[model samples]
Target: MIHLEFNSESENEGIARVLAATYMMKFDPTMEEMADVKTAVSEAVTNCIVHGYEDDQGKIFMDISNEGSVLKIVIEDFGVGIPDVKQAMEPMYTTKPDEERTGMGFSFMEAFMDKIEVSSESGKGTRVIMEKKVTGK
Candidate 1:
């Protein structure tokens, strides 16, 4: 198990990218798979920075590990949680249209990863768990 904590910011995403990069080489994943991992992590961390904490100072807990044959990532944030997860997951569903949010974050995770799970409560917090198989090509 590898543990890393990052601030919810764009600059901090580089750390995430680095982690993904190192993990990819360890697992010998394909370039395409590595790209998916980076993109998915960016989306997850971006959500933590933007909607999770409302662009405020917050900590993003990044849990990365190999689960036998699977690569797992769990990102947890202690910030405003989603009230309507169903609506949020819908394509082009933006709570802040004026902010120009594409509402594609969750969808991208779903598309890029094999399994995705989200749990949140209003005024409590949110946690996103994603898993994908890593196969050398």
Candidate 2:
């Protein structure tokens, strides 16, 4: 298991992706699996920065672990939580349309990972849990 906590900065998105990929290396995942996991991590971290914090700085927590071939990831942010998680997950539905945000973050995450679950409170925070099966191991 690996746990990470970092500032909700845009640059940290890449860091999180790299760290996830590096940690998965021990499982000898395929290139496609690596890319999928990296993309999912990127989207999760980006959401924490662009939407969760929304120009404010906060801590993002991530926990990663594997059980057999299944990889599990949980990312959390203590920022302005989503008022409606179901609406937010809909494709092409973005609150910040003026910023050219495509609202595909959750879509991409669901596409790349085998399973994803999200929970949020209006004034508390948001948590995203994702799981994938790495077959290369």
Candidate 3:
């Protein structure tokens, strides 16, 4: 298990992705699998910086753990939480329409990970939990 907390900066998103990929090394996943995990991690962290904190300098927490062949990742932010989590996860649903946001963060996470669970409360925060099973490990 590993835990990471970093400022909600765009550069930190890459850091988070690298750290996640490093942690996943123990699972002995292939290049494609690692790439998938990195992409999902990037999206989750980017969401925290872009939407959660709105680039106002907040904190993002990440937790990673592996059990058997399954790897669990949890990304959390304490910024303004989503008012409608279900609506937020819907494809092409972005609050920042003028910013050219594709609103595909959650969609990408869902596509790469075996499972994705999101929880949030208005004015509280948001949590994104994802799990992937590494085969042939």
Candidate 4:
């Protein structure tokens, strides 16, 4: 397992994705698997920055681990938590309409990862857990 903590900034999203990819290298994931994990990580980190922090800077935590063929990733933030997780996961439902946000972050994550679980509170925080099986290994 590996733990990462970074500031909830737009630039850090790339870093998070790269870190996830690098960590998965040991599993020898295929191009598709690598892309899927990177994209999912990007979406999770971006959510922490745009929705969780909401223009404010906060800490985002990520934990990655693997067992056999399954890779698990957890991204969390202690900023303003989600008020309605179900509604937020709905396609095309974005809180920032003015920003032209597509609201497809969660959808993409779900499509790419084998399983995803999200938990959040009104003020405590939000946590997104994603898991995928690397068949190429």
Q: What is the C-alpha local distance difference test score of each model?
A: 0.86, 0.94, 0.91, 0.93
Error of 3 at 105 (Å): 0.9
Candidate 2 lDDT, tens digit per residue, 2-68? Answer: 9999998888889899998988888899999999999999999998999889989999999999998
Q: What lDDT tens digits, residue by residue, belong to model 3 across residues 21-137?
A: 888888789988899999999999988888899959988999999889799999999999999999999998999989969989899999999999999988778999999998744
TM-score of each: 0.94, 0.97, 0.96, 0.97
**Candidate 1 vs 4: which has more TM-score:** 4
lDDT of the structure predicted as candidate 2: 0.94
Lowest lDDT block of 10, candidate 1: 17-26
Clashing pairs in 4: none
lDDT of 1: 0.86
Clashes of each: 0, 0, 0, 0
Residue pairs whose backbone atoms clash in candidate 2: none
Looking at model 3, which ten-residue stretch has the lowest summed lDDT?
Answer: 128-137
Residue pairs with backbone overlap in model 1: none
